[model samples]
Target chain A: MLGYTLRRILQMIPVLLGATFIIYALTFLMPGDPIAALTGERPLPEATVAQIRQAYHLDDPFFVQYGNYILGVFRGDFGIDFFGRPVLDLILERLPVTFALAVTAWGLKLVIGLVIGVYGGLRAGKAADHFALVFTVLFMGIPGFVIALGGQTYFGVHLGWVDPAGIRAGWPMAFILPALVMALEAAAGLARLTRTSLVDVLRAEYLRTAKAKGLSPQRIIWGHALRNAMIPVVTYLGLSLAGMLGGAVIIEAIFNLPGIGGLMVASINNKEGTVVVGIATLLVLVYLVFNLLVDLTYGLIDPRVRI
Target chain B: MTQLLEVRDLRVQFSTAQGTATAINGVNLSLEHGQSLGILGESGSGKSVTARTIMGLLDMPPAKINGGEILLEGEDLLTATAKRRRQLTGPVMSMVFQDALSALNPVHPVGRQIGELYRVHRGYSRKAAKAAAIEMMDRVRIPAAASRVNDYPHQFSGGMRQRIVIAMALALDPQLLIADEPTTALDVTVQAQILELLKEQQAENNMGLILITHDISVVREVTDQVAVMYAGRIVEQGPTAHVLGDPRHPYTLGLSQSVANEDLKGRRLPAIEGSPPDLLALPRGCSFANRCPLADEQCSSSAPPLESVGAGRTSACFHSGKVASNVAYSN
Candidate 1:
């Protein structure tokens, strides 16, 4: 197991490197002149323009810039933002907001997914299964941004319950709408996945043997079936976590929430190349880390999954 | 005589794309305490379904038992509540399935799984359960019982896993054990070992065992009574020795003759012609009528109910009323 894990970590290095390259190249091609954005147009001199270009290494060839950035990664120097702030510091500041939103959404999805999945799986072909089917259809039929809109109109505007337009002081009200939207998106897929996995696992011969041995339905489920069914959910959840931050961008925009997502949009609109790159890099890192955690969880859930 | 288990008019139907199909139809059987009953038939003969129905483990939506009475020690299992039915399983009754590899959970320790009967139903603490598991492992004669207790199901061979299942079944010393083709996946030697272990466990606990299998020779060594199933009903049933010694049902006689018993060598093996009928489109007559040598016009129009042929034997055939070995009828 240890050897398998070490090998997996080694295997991920190239994947991470490849992802970073794509992000770097894609950002460069996005048609933004960071030098022009940073140095204002009024009475700007040619020498100052060249200096601005040199400062951010935009004057260098594309391959050279890529090579230098890859090398700079090892030295912990991701260069400076358009406003001259350190990229790392900028990323660290926005990290908590995105983390809080994604984590809360992920947690809610896990709880709701497991409950619906197990219930539908246990009483398969019954009302629970039908209810789960309908619930999943309702959420999956709509996109995250749409649900965010509906939730704001119904719960925030019509009901006058929540501050639909903006994220407020405390963490509770701040995360409510964003988390709900993300969960609605996640729960739809998860409920369907849970139902399929639960049904399959419950029908396994081990479950029958457990039944033949007179173990209670509750014991069979909690002790054995649920653990096995969590495998696919783990993989799905990990991939979902990677995209969690991205999903909040539109919802955060509608809500006027000054979270990392809003910061990302503002940074892009302002042509803050360093901030955009920094946030993108942070997302890539989150993706890698969550993938690793999922691998570890697979081992915990079933010994057969070595890595 | 106190019957340990009785299954009367048990019919299991399945709603399929074709229509409602009866898998087991009006099957009647009885077994006494401390006795072993062997149910032999080819695949899809409804043997496993019968055993599953008796255990109350059949998933109900697609599988519906139209009518039946599964009386286990005078308790009607057919209408029993889920809780009551569960209570009758494990220590009271258990089953060993055909495929051992798939039967045990791959991720859990075999011993811990075996000990779970005590842990879940009996409420034994983890440590106590572990100890009891080791003891049960030893009783089943698993080598290095203490050391191997923590080994997962995949670590054991096919035969050994079946023994673990048997040990698990008898751990709580249930009154009845239903073994559905327990030796089907095993080699000759291991099959013998498993059968011996099961027989030992049954005798030691005074338990009644219903062994379901497609192979008749495997059950000859241990079972006291034998029931032959065709399509979805018992065609013949009697004391194993009497039935094997002087077979009555044409299907039963043909089945035993087809097998290469020691004395029946040096002759062309009498193979039954044609395949088993599909339950969905089964004929209205005796299910075995097409394959029977004694089949006639009367056999094709209507099905025959199980009728007495001897003092303690019954067969579902119209003409075979007397135990005449010379009676010959062939299609």
Candidate 2:
């Protein structure tokens, strides 16, 4: 198991390199000079523009600029943005808001998905199972942004149940709508996956053995079937963490929240290459770490996976 | 000895897309305290279904107990409430299934799997359950029971896993243990060991046993009486020695002929011709009439009821006396 984990960690190096290369290459291929964009529509002396380009390594070849950026990253320097602010500090300041939204959404999805899934799986082909199946399918079919908008109008404007937009001192209530909207689609998929996987596991021979052992229905489901069924669910949950981070961009934009995803999008529109690439690198790191944790969890949930 | 389990005219049917298949039809079985009954049959002969129905493990929508009575210690299991059945399962009777690896929960440790019986039914504390698990493991002859108890199902070898399954089944000392093809998934040497362990345990506990297997030698070695089942019905049943030595029903005669005999080592072993009858559309007369060499107009036109032969034997064949004499002369 340790060997497998170490090997997986080593495998992440190329994925990280590829991610950094893509982000760097994308900025390089962008039309017009970043320094010119930085200078905006105001006219400047040719020497001043050239000096600005040279200082930012914008005057160098693509490979040279990319190499220099990679070196800066290794040295913990994400470089300065258009406003002369350190991109790392900018990302750090915005990290908490994004983490709060994504983590809460992930938590909501996990809990709700698992509950619906287990209920549906245990009572398969019954009314509860049918309801859960149809509910998840409907949630999955609708887009997340639509839900966010609809929720804001219904829960915030019409019902006055929540603020619907913006973080307040009592942020938990403020986060509810956005977080729930963020969770809906993923939770629906998870609920379906959980239901199917649990149904399959419940049909396994060991559950019959558990029943023959005179275990209560609760013990058989929770103690025996649920543990084995959660293996695939854990993998999905880990992958969903990466997905939630990426998904937060549109959700944050829709809700007008100041999370990293929103920051990345704003930077992209402004062609602030440093901030965009810096945030992209952080996301890539998060993706790699979560995948590694998922692999480790496989061993924890199923002993056979350790080999 | 008092009867421990009495199954009278048990009929089980499954509603499939094809049709309503009668898996077990008009099966009558009874076991006394400390007696072992080996139910021998080929694949798809309803051996496992019978065991599952007896344990109340079959799901009702697909599988229905069309008609029957399963009386455990004079209490009808069919009418028993779900809670009452659950209460009776672990302490009153339990079953060991085929395929030990799949039979034991893959996620739990062996000790925990065995200990769960006591924890759920008896409400044993974790410490006490663990101790009892070790003791059961020791009884099943799993080496280093104290240390190995913590190991998961995958950690143990197949035979050891099967032993763990048996240990779990008999942990609460249930009055009856129904092992459904328990050794079918084991190596020959390991099969012998498991059978021996089961026999010893049954003897020690004075519990009734139902050993279901396709292997004739296994049945002969472990059971006092044998019932030959073909297409959901018992073709013949009697003391093991008497039945195997001189089979009455043509189906049982054919089955005994299929077994490898040292006296006929030089020649090809005989096999029962034709496959088992289709369960979805069984013959109105006798299920095995198509395959029985002695089958005639009477055999094909009407099903023969189980009739008494001499010496506490029963055979469901019109020509039981003739077939037994023919088999005797041939031997």
Candidate 3:
């Protein structure tokens, strides 16, 4: 197991390098010069532009610039944005809000998805199951931005159940509504996946053996069936965790939450390449880590899974 | 004493997209305590269904017991409340399935699965259950039961897994053990060992055993009495020796003749002609008529009733005498 973990960690190096290169390349390829855009209609003098560009190594070829950036990253340097604030510090400040938002959304999806899934799976073809089917389809069909904007209007504006916009209230109060909207699509997909996986597990021959062993329905379903069913669901959940963290940009923008997502969007618009690359790198790290954790969790849930 | 189990006119039907198929039609069976009965049949012969129905493991709606009385120790299981039936499952009766790999829950440790019976039925503490699990494992002759207890079902070999399944079924010392093709998935050499283990356990517990199998040799080796089923109905039933030695039903005779033997080496073994009838659209007469060599016009016109042919023997055929003479001449 230790050897496996070491190997997996080693494998992440190439993936991280690849992801960083892609983000850096995309940032480098963005239309409009950051230096020229900074001056904004009042073009910077040629000498000042040269000085700034030289200091940042902006005139270097793409691969050379990427190599320099990677070296800086290895030494814990993410460079400064156009506003002179360290990109790492900028991301760190907003990291908590995004982390909290993503986690809240994740928790919401896990709970809602499992409840609906287990309920529907056990009572398949019944009214509740049909309702779950329709509910999942409805949520899955609508785009996330639509749900966010619609939810913001109905609940935040008309119903007056929440603040219409912004995170001035802070913490849970500000995060809940947008997180819920963010959770819906994933929760629906998860419910469908969980339902199908659970239904398949319930029909497995082991469940019959469990029943024939004289286990109660509750024990049989929860004990014998749920763990096996959860194997696939856990993989989905882990992938979605990475997705929620990176994909919360629209939700954060709609709710005006000062999270990394909103920061990324603002930085992208302002042509702050450093901030965008920094946040993308963090997301890549998070994706790799969560995937590893999911693999580890498999061994815990199923004894047959060695690692 | 009341028979260990009694099934009187038990009928099971399955509703499918195609149609309602009578899987077990007018089947009757009885077993005395400590005796072994082999229910011999091919795939879709409803032998497995009969075992599952008796165990109360059949899924309703798709499967329905149209009419039957499954009596366990003189108490009709058909009329028993769900809760009562559940109560009887572990202590009164239990079942071992065909494929041990699929039958044993893969995620759980083998010990916990076997221990579950004690934990749920006997109210044993987790530690006590673990200890009991090891004990059960040892009884099944799994090597190093203590160490292997923590291993999952997939960790064990096919034969070892079946033993674990048998251990779980016998955990509470149920009066009856229904082994549904328990050795079917095992290696040829391992098959004999599993059968031997089952027989040993049955004798030690004095448990009524229903060994369901398609293998004639397995039946002859393990069971005292044998019932031959065709198209969901029992066509011949008697002492295993008598039934296998002198089959009264043509279907039974065909089944016996099909078995490969030393004498039949290098010769084309005579196989029963035609497949079993489609249950969804069964003919009004004997379901096996199409496949039976001795099938006459009368055999196709009317279904034969199960009737006494000899001491403790019953044959469902209009020409049992003819079949017996044929068997005698062949021998």
Candidate 4:
């Protein structure tokens, strides 16, 4: 198991490099000069531009610039943005907010998804099952931005539940509504997947054996069926966690949470390649780690699966 | 004293997309203590359904008992409360299913599965149940039961897994054990081993065993009495040797001929022509009329009732006298 984990971690290096390279290349290909954009109204003089370009190695080819950036990254340097602020510091500042948001959304998704999914699966072809199906379809059908806008209007403008936007009101209060909005689509998908998986597991022949052994219906479902059903649900939840941690740019924009997502968008618009590439690198690491965790979790849930 | 089990006019039906399909049609059976009865049939002949219905394992709504009384030592299980039935299961009666790989829960250790009976029915402690599980495993003849107790179902071979299932079913030493095609998924040699184990367990516990299977040789090897089923009804029933030796019903005669034998080498074995009748829209007359060579107007006009043809034997056929004479000509 230790060897497997080590190999998985080792495999992440190439993936991380590839992801960072793509983000850097895309940012580099964007039109307009960062230094020129920095001095928007009054353009910088030729000599000052040259000095800044020489210092930042902006005139070098893409490969040379990428090589320099990678070398700096190995030494824990993420370079600087157009505003002369260290990109690593900028990412670190927003890390906690994004972490809190992602965790909240992930928790909400799991609880809501599992509860509704299991309920629906157990009562399949009945009213509860129909309700779950409709609920999932409705949520899944609507786009994320539309849901965010509608939530803002209903909860913020009409009901006065809490502040419509921004994190000024504090940790949980500000996070709940946006996190819920962020959680909706993925939760719907998770609930549907859970329902399908659970329904299939419930009908498995082993469950009949459990019943024949004279186990009560409750024990049959909870003890035997749920563990097997959880295999696929766990996989789905892990992937969604990785996705949530990658950040929801639209939700962050609408709710105005100063998260990594918002930072990423603002940096891209300003052509701050260092900040964008840094955030992308962090997301790549998160994805790889969660994937490894999911694979490891499979071995634990099902003894048949060896690491 | 009451028999170990008695199923009188037991009827089972399934509501399918087409219509209500009568899977088990007025089947009657009785087993004495320590006796083994084999229910012989082809696929979809309701042998498995009968065993499952007896175990109360069939899912209702899709499957419903139209009319029946399953008496376990004089108590009508059909009238028993759901909780009462549950209490009876594992302690009073239990079942072993086909496909042992699917029958045993994959995630749990084989020992835990076997031990679950003691834990649930006997209220044994976890440690006690584990010890009992190892003991049951040893009884079923699983090698190194103590060491292999923690291994999951997937870790075991097919035959060994079936042994684990048997150990679990017999854990509480229930009066009745319904094994539905238990050896169907095993190798020929492995099948013999499982049968031997079952026979040994039955004798040791003096348990009434109902072996449901399509294999004639298996039934002959394991059971004392036999009931040949066709279209969900018992067409012929008597002592295993008597029924197999002189099959009174045309269907039973056909089934006996279908088995491969040394004398029939290089000769075309006579198989029962046509498939079993569809449960939905069954003909008013005999279900086997279409497939029987002796099917006449009388056989087609009305279904034959099961009647005594000889000592301790019953055959559901209008022309039982001719069945024996016709068997020689078929050869």
Overall lDDT per candidate, in order of appearance: 0.83, 0.89, 0.91, 0.91
DockQ for the candidates, in order: 0.60, 0.84, 0.84, 0.90
Q: Between 1 and 3, whose lDDT is larger?
A: 3
**Window of ten residues with lowest summed lDDT in model 2 chain B:** B322-331
Give candidate 1's whole-model lDDT: 0.83
lDDT of 2 by residue, A1-307 (tens): 7788789988987898899999989977877766666667896899988788778877789888888888898899999887789999999998888888888899998888988888898888999999999999899999887888999999999999988777773457877888898787788889888999999998999999999998888888889899899989999999899878888888888877888978998888788888899999999989999988888878889888876
lDDT of 1 by residue, B11-101 (tens): 9999999898789989999988999999989888999999999987898878999998999888899888988998889877889898888
Question: What is the RMSD, in Å, between candidate 2 and the native fold over all Cα?
Answer: 2.0
Q: What residue runs in model 2 are displaced by over 4 Å at the alpha carbon?
A: A1-7, B325-331
Model 1 TM-score relative to the real fold = 0.93
Q: List the residue pairs that clash in candidate 2.
A: none
- Over 4 Å off, model 1: A40-43, B260-270, B321-331
DockQ of 2: 0.84
Specify the CAPRI tier of model 2: high
Please provide, for model 2 over B1-331, each residue's C-alpha lDDT reduced to its tens digit, 9 standing for 90 to 100: 4589999999999999999999999999999889999999999898889999999999887999989899999999999999999999989999988999999888889999999888988999999999999999998989999999888899999999999999999999999999999999999999999999999999999999999999988999999988889889988998988898888888777777877778878877787778998899999888888877677889888999988987878999988988965642122
Each model's TM-score? 0.93, 0.97, 0.98, 0.98
Where does candidate 4 stray beyond 4 Å? B328-331
List the pairs of residues colliding in candidate 4: none
Model 2 preserves the real interface contacts to a fraction of 0.88
